[model samples]
Each structure stands twice: as structure tokens, then as C-alpha cells.
Target: MPRLKAEDAERREAAGHGPDFLEALARGLAVLQAFGPERRQMTLAETARVVDLPRATVRRALHTLVTLGHVESDGRLFRLTPRVLRLASGYLGANGLSAILQPRCERLSAEVGAPCSAAVLDGGDIVFIAYGQPARLLNLTTMVGLRLPAFCTALGRVLLAGLPEAEMDAVLAQHPPFAVTPQTELDPLRIRKRIAKARSDGFALVDQEAEQGFRSLAVPLRRHDGRVVAALNIGMHSERGTATVLRDSYLPLLRAQATDLAPQLL
Candidate 1:
């Protein structure tokens, strides 16, 4: 449809390309994002609908991307080329967090016989950046790119503990906590106390708080300056054990690993 181009043209014309803004580039990137992990390939109509762009605009963007070796297309289907991975690889390489933490997470997962991860705060949520797991069957599982509300999760609490008082309040205010489970805590005062404990105690553990039948323990991963940057967590089914058991048994090991890895992250 010609409408997508017209829509984009309207945005650019309104902005007058002010102060380094590039509407066409933004639209092309949006087209690329329409292909996610679950959506590996799309027909023209699928891409147009997913990106909410007009079909003609999507077609032009796809053609430009294909020529630049960022996208590939058959006569009827379009998909991202492997070249797109360069974007993620550059992030992983530049940060070096995944490279340094992933192997440690694997070892920790094997030792604890549970899933393990490292996550960073994003607004009112925590996003998993590195993940590892054992073979135990779980009712719920977390993976890289999984996002969970910060207040109800051990990972989130430990990360929130890193922030100063005003900043932490602002972070929490970004989203009103809603129930994922009956056990999820939404009270600001109670959450503030949990974060305080996580800061003084250096770890947080919760059972059936984020989700029913699941438990997690987390420790802060800090830089050499001792500023927390991410959280390291281990999660298991609630049937496995209680929060106290993990705190006494697995937490020492988790903290040790986090401490050992902190300097490497610098």
C-alpha cells in the first residue's frame, strides 16, 4: 500500500529532519524488529501487519535491507540474514558480561541443580542477559530476554538494592505492581524493607513470590567500585526446598561466585 510511505513521509515532513533525526532509518529498523526470535520469516503482508507499516513501505525497506545484506528474501517470504547477529555480537563483545558470566552460571547451575541467570534492571523490571540451567523439570522457566517485575523477584530486589533511595523510588514508580500470584508483594513499604535487607545482607531469596511453585535466590553482581550492576540468581521449583534452605546452602556459593567474577567484569 502507498499509505505506509505517505505515513512515514508525513512524520519526516512534520519534523523537518531536525537535529539529526532520521525518520526513514527509524522505520527501516522497525521493519527489522518485526522479525523476532519467534518470527524468523514473514511474507510481505505479515511484515507489514507486524510493523504496522503500509505494505509498499515495508517492501521498499526490505529491498534496501536485502541489498545491504541485512535481510534475505525468497519470491514470497522475507527473513533476516545472519548478518543481523552482528548487532548483538557487538553488544556482547563490547560489554564482555555474557562472555564472563555465562560459563560461571553454567557451573553454578550444575552445582545447584537448578536454573541460573544474570539480569539487569530495566525500568520496573529485570531482563535476563545470561542464562544457564540443569535438566530438572520446572513448572516455569526463565531465559535470556525474559522480563519480570522487580519488586516480587529476588533478582529484582537485589538489583533495586543497588540504587539510591530516590532513584529506587522512581524506578518502582514506573509500573504499578499487579498480582502475578497471591504471594506477590506490592506494598511500597514492604518492598522498601526487602530492598534494604538485600542491601545489608548482600542477597535476597523468595519463594512463590514472582510465580506460584517457584523459588529464587539472588546476589548482587557489582563492579570493582562496589556499585551493583546486575544480579545473579538461581531458581528452582518450590517443591525442591524452602527459601531458608537455599539461603543457607546455595547463597554462600552464589555470593562467592559473584565476588570472584566482579573484578573480571571491570
Candidate 2:
């Protein structure tokens, strides 16, 4: 296949662009995002299938990304290069939210001897921007930049709860709940109720939904204007604590941290 020239690619991508929107850039980002933990590397055909774009289109995007050092291709398969992390690092640096929340998450993790994280809702997923883990080794590991479904995590629930009712309904409709585990809630009505409860109660507690044997408690990190910009959560094994124990013991701590950080989020 011939490499697509910049102008040619832009002309081809014009079909999806509006007056201000850059369709070519969006396609490039979509192609970059198609590679994930499950898909460390993929062939051109596989990439086309995953992104639902024509093989030629995906090839051009991959070729352009490779030229920019954001992706690497061995002529058959492609993978994201370390240079892509620059995008994440740049966002963290400019946004400053991760830097601000990192120390707080570490303190919370140390206090409870568990893993803690802060995440923001992006589309139907929650992206971890900051994370902390205790000194001791544990079976599970969570980290920054991890993305998980919104309907199944405490962090995600709290973040979603912060959205307006109509917006929340649309989001739920767009991404219907799926069962991550047997304990995961698949009912949209029940999930909405849980989100509503989080909005009213100022906290969310989820048990073994995202991962079996893991229970998490979360609270919304709000700005001075009372707008929730992120969610804070801590997770532990279900064997270590029941739902009531997690709620009673950890909810206050989470809420306290959220409150303390609210003023800084602005």
C-alpha cells in the first residue's frame, strides 16, 4: 500500500469533520487508543477491525503515527511507543490535578493500609489519574492511567453520580451495564438507584463488582463550586471487611480527603 500524504489523508478524513473539528486528528487518536492492555500489538487488519475503519485508512493513520514516533510498526503489526506516554505526562503536568491528588492518595492508602485512586469519568470509562498503594505486597495492583468501566466501580459510580440527571441517563443508555463479575450489577435501574444514592449520601460503596473479593468505597472530589471533577476511592479484600464495615470505617476518611481537596481542585 502507498503511504498517504498529509494532504491526501486530510482530504479523505474530511468526511467526518465539521467546521472546527479535525477528523484526521480524531482518527489518529482513535487508532492510538485502539491499542491497550489486552491488545499490546495488532496487525493492520486487526487494527482496522477494532477501530471499524477501512484497512487503507488505518494503515495511513498507523503510518503517520509511526513517522511521528507515537507508534511503531514492523510492516505487519503495530504497537504504541513510549512516546505516546508523553501525551499523558503532558496532561498531568498541565492539568496539575494528578500532582495535587497524588500525595493525598498516598496518605489515604497509608492510613488504611490499602490501595487508593483518583479517577475522572471519560466517556463510559473512568480513567485513573492518580493512585497509591501500601508498602506491603498485595495480590492486586492498581495504577495510574488504568481505565475501567464506569458502571462497575466505586470511583466510577461516584463520578457518574455527579453528572446531571438527563446527562446521566443518556450516558447509561449509551453504555449499558455489563456484568464484570457475578456480583456486578447489570440492571440499569438498580445502577441508577445506586448512583442516585451516591449523589444524596455523598459516597458510594461497591462490593466485588469490578473485581471479585475486592470492595471499594468512594466519594466525589468536588471543587469550590460544588461541581464534582473527580472521584476518590480505596479498595480492600472483601474477606478483610464487609460492606457495612467498609462504609462505616472508610467512608468518613474518604469524605474527609475529598472535602480537603475540594478547595484545591479549582
Give residue 117's lDDT in candidate 2 (0 to 100): 89
Give the winner by lDDT: 2
Q: Assess candidate 1 and give its lDDT.
A: 0.86
In angstroms, how far off is 87's CA in candidate 1? 2.8
Give candidate 2 misplaced runs (Cα > 4 Å).
Answer: 1-17, 138-142
The per-residue C-alpha lDDT of model 1 at residue 37 equals: 61
lDDT of 2 by residue, 1-266 (tens): 24555555566567655356666788888999999999999999999999998999899999999999999988888999999989998988887789999888888888889888899999899999999888895636557889999988999898999999899888889998888899999988899999999889988889999999999989999999999999999888888978999889888888788778887997
Q: Which candidate is the best by TM-score?
A: 2
lDDT of each: 0.86, 0.88
Candidate 1 local Cα displacement, residue 17, angstroms: 14
Model 2: what TM-score? 0.91
Residue range with the least summed lDDT across 10 consecutive positions in model 1: 136-145
Summarize candidate 1's per-residue lDDT along 73-158 as a digit string, tens digits: 88899999889878866876777777888788888888888888999898999988888888664536447666788999999999
RMSD of each predicted structure: 5.0, 3.8
- The Cα error of candidate 2 at residue 15, in Å, is 11
